[model samples]
Target: MRSRSSNRFSRPSAQRGVALVIALVLLVLMTLLGLTSMRGVALEERMTGNTYDRSLSFQAAESALREAEALVEANRPTPAALAACVNGICGSPNPADLERWLDPAFPSPPNPGGWQAATQVSNGPISLTPQYIVEYLGDTFPCQPGNPASTNDCKRYRITARSAPGGDRSVVMLQSVFATD
Candidate 1:
């Protein structure tokens, strides 16, 4: 039998650097995995930020809509001008304006002819200024008996409000109808 000392160091030389090579390969693969994970996280963060901006824009639009409705309600004494409306419905996209507020295909400007710039809205806080139009839907039939004094000369108004976030292409549009006294 061979001496114990001779057998102890007689292992194959080819395996000497195999462990080191395996360790380096593993390290490279782990680094690649880490980079991929980081990229995914970054993308998610961007998406979340966009969602927040969209929310803000929608809220602003809703606020504008309420304001327009209130204004129409306040005009209780005098009747709204129907001749100024586009087809007697859209106040801004009137026949004289270059852009049509009611048309989705048209890129509506904030200040179309008869459109009134919204007041009580902070221009700096909101991305886009809100605009409103008061359309007068002609006479309405009496909802009750044939009493002339009881007949209500009700007028209909259509209000449209738009809001958008800064640096984002997304926009929010809100529209509502209101009846006058």
Candidate 2:
């Protein structure tokens, strides 16, 4: 009876810091989770910014190409001018003449120094600058009336424009053709 009473009176040993350890572990896990979420958000923002820059660059390039094509069409030189040239037609107006036609008075110069001249249609000319790079590909092959391979007297031109917005570069290409009818 005495022994039983003594045992009942004895206080149970305290749970040695188990609660503290659990609390610390939980805190560490929560901190890690928060940090990971923060990192993910930051990465997403960066990606969005980059995408926007690329989009702007591509738009600029496309605009440049369109301007160039219009210039080519407008400045188709005389048949004599196209004949003197080698690449396509020396007697007809060439890309160089087209470049010259780009009015400097415009807000942006269509054919800056970066504009390159092509001798033949093939890859055409390329322009490289700190702000952007453009590639113009022209085709003078006339299309055939009946046969797909055969060419008529029409000429085709393609221009590719590439630009970098805030140093983030992108490319845009455009193609067009003119007939001597």
Question: Which candidate achieves the best lDDT against the true structure?
Answer: 1
Q: Output the lDDT of residue 154, model 1.
A: 67
Judge candidate 2 at residue 181 and give its lDDT. Answer: 21
Q: Give the lDDT of residue 94 in candidate 2.
A: 57
lDDT of each structure? 0.61, 0.46
Location of the lowest summed lDDT over 10 successive residues in candidate 1: 85-94
Candidate 2 lDDT score relative to the true structure: 0.46
Kindly report which residue pairs in candidate 1 clash with one another.
none
> Which stretches of candidate 1 lie above 4 Å from their native place?
1-5, 8-12, 76-82, 85-99, 102-114, 120-128, 141-150, 164-169
